[model samples]
Target: MIADRARQAAAAAALVGCLLAAHGTAAADAAAGARLSAARCASCHSSTETIHSTVPLLEGQPKAYFIAQWRAFRERKRTAPVMVNLAGELSEKDVADLAEHYAALAPPPAALASGSDTGRALADRLRCAACHGSALRGTHAGAARLAGQKVQYTTWSLQLMRSGTRSHGTAAKPDPLLADLSNAEIESLAAHLASLR
Candidate 1:
């Protein structure tokens, strides 16, 4: 299983490289994405910066990553209950517009626990920037933007991924990194990410 994940990660890494070349450095247009979001996703993804624990913050995510996720949802490869049906209804333009809208918004700020020094080091060592970009923001590779994500949500999600109990999408490959963490490590990591500006 570990070998399989390594292979998957390698493939994903290559895909990310290709996407970077293709996308250059273009970020999405917030105005267009916002209009689409208001029309299509305002109910769950409230206009306010506050995000519920179950839902992820979409703002400031990379357009390419957001598009990729929507496509995955549409194809039934990824599995967010709320997203599965909705994704199928979105037109390609809607996907692009929404991506830009979320990407334009800033991540909401949150406080973190002190004394998580080791966790901070671990995050840096993970080289999350390799895919998520230097700012821990989503990049052209379709990585989810992690800066200022809710700590509880991030922690819960990580726990699920590690335990193989939570599924992001049906076809979503498990993150191999999550498989090796202890509970403390996960919490620390979550705290570190949530504290990002």
Candidate 2:
């Protein structure tokens, strides 16, 4: 319990620091971002399909949040190997442009799968809506939309967050409650959320 609290506190601090950084970043052009994405990001993040179950669907993510995540990846604060290299390849303008491109897209459909019934209740208890919006479509404040995220990606992401390997940018703390979740429980939760519009 203490460890979970500590992790949450650390995450909260990081969120503040990141939100501050986001305010001063420059704007980007979606067209320019699209061109760059085609070259560097398309293979893994292609909205047409899930290349891997763990890769996130980037469409309609909040632009500022998207920029902040790329910046974090570029700066070595985040821990995705492919994203770090891709983010490093981008110039500041490219980062902004790419964020713009992804942000302008409509949320694509994800492959939904079967799971237990507890996920929705767990999400309610977690108050996911406090940050992800009532409908989970994301906000300018940094939450990514979860409604159409791949079930595998969502389950993996929740596990990472619970295990302290990933975070919801810098705004909120990792949920200590998730530490008690079994793998099947996490999958059920992910499945339910993915079923939302």
Candidate 3:
């Protein structure tokens, strides 16, 4: 219980920091962002049918969260070959526009939960809601929306975080909550998260 509370406190602190950092942003132009996305991001991110299993769905993400991630990729604080290169090309206004565009779109629908009850229990114990909102739909705290996310993407991301290959750029720390979980447990947690709408 104490450990869980500690984690929640940490998450809350991170949220506050992000909120402060994202303050004073200019209004974004979603229309311009749409055009830019169509021109540049369509090949991978726009196509629901052709997108890889590991590609996260960005629609309906919080604008602050989206902007933070885009900047991370652009600054090379978070590393993905294509995203680093692509995000590098975007201006600050371009990122804000894209954030607005994607944030306004509807998120993906929920999928069936294939995991057992244990997954739900694990999420409850972990208090994922502390960071992800009551519905796991995300928060203005710079946390990504998790509801109805692709299972494969969630699973892979957890594994990367656990293995220390992925981390929050600002925090620079892998989630300790994920460190001790087994592969099967991570998959179960991902399934539970994917099932929420």
Candidate 4:
């Protein structure tokens, strides 16, 4: 009986040690995430700055969504040639760290200055609401929220669509509305869409 009890005690102690080690590892990951964000992502994506005509703020995004994008970039499923190279350099742990860092950030302000009524009308006509939802919060699966997205990212994505470069499974054709739009219209739409909180 004494020998059996000793074995049980050892097992319990091992379990406790494992639990503590797991907690410590999680804390370390969060710290690493913060550091990585400052080093790699702060230039184009701000956590706390006001929403401007260009950069996109990446705070408070869903962790799964954020990680999925990084994975897609890494896998070349989402083809931003520049992003592909950048994301290729990250390991799974680095991706998790960056996602956690952005997920913990505060979202930026929502004040866009779109200069064209035509672009807004076109967006509405194109049924951008179908997949992106009424407020562009994005569908739960596969779709990304466009509200408060970076203007540069949005415009660049649209340009890619126009060029037959960026191909998402959910998106069918090049955004027909965007295809007909002039450069100015695209810019106005990007700025206005990014302004939505």
Q: Give RMSD to native, each candidate.
A: 12.6, 12.9, 12.5, 6.0
Q: Evaluated with TM-score, which candidate comes out highest?
A: 3
**Candidate with better lDDT, 2 vs 3:** 3
Question: Residues 51-137, candidate 4, lDDT per residue (tens digit)?
Answer: 443445667665667778888888888775867998998877887787778666655665444435765775687677787778776
Each candidate's clash count: 9, 1, 0, 0
In order, candidate lDDTs are 0.74, 0.79, 0.80, 0.69
Reference-based lDDT, residue 185, model 3 = 90
The digit string of per-residue lDDT tens for model 3 on 14-93 reads 99988987885667899998998888875566444535678888877888888888888988888889999988888898
Report how far residue 88 has shifted in candidate 3, in Å: 1.0
Q: Which structure is stronger by TM-score: 1 or 2?
A: 2
Rank by TM-score, highest first: 3, 2, 1, 4
Comparing 3 and 4 by TM-score, which wins? 3
| Candidate 2 local lDDT, residue 98 | 84
Residue 100 lDDT in candidate 2: 84
TM-score of each: 0.71, 0.77, 0.78, 0.64
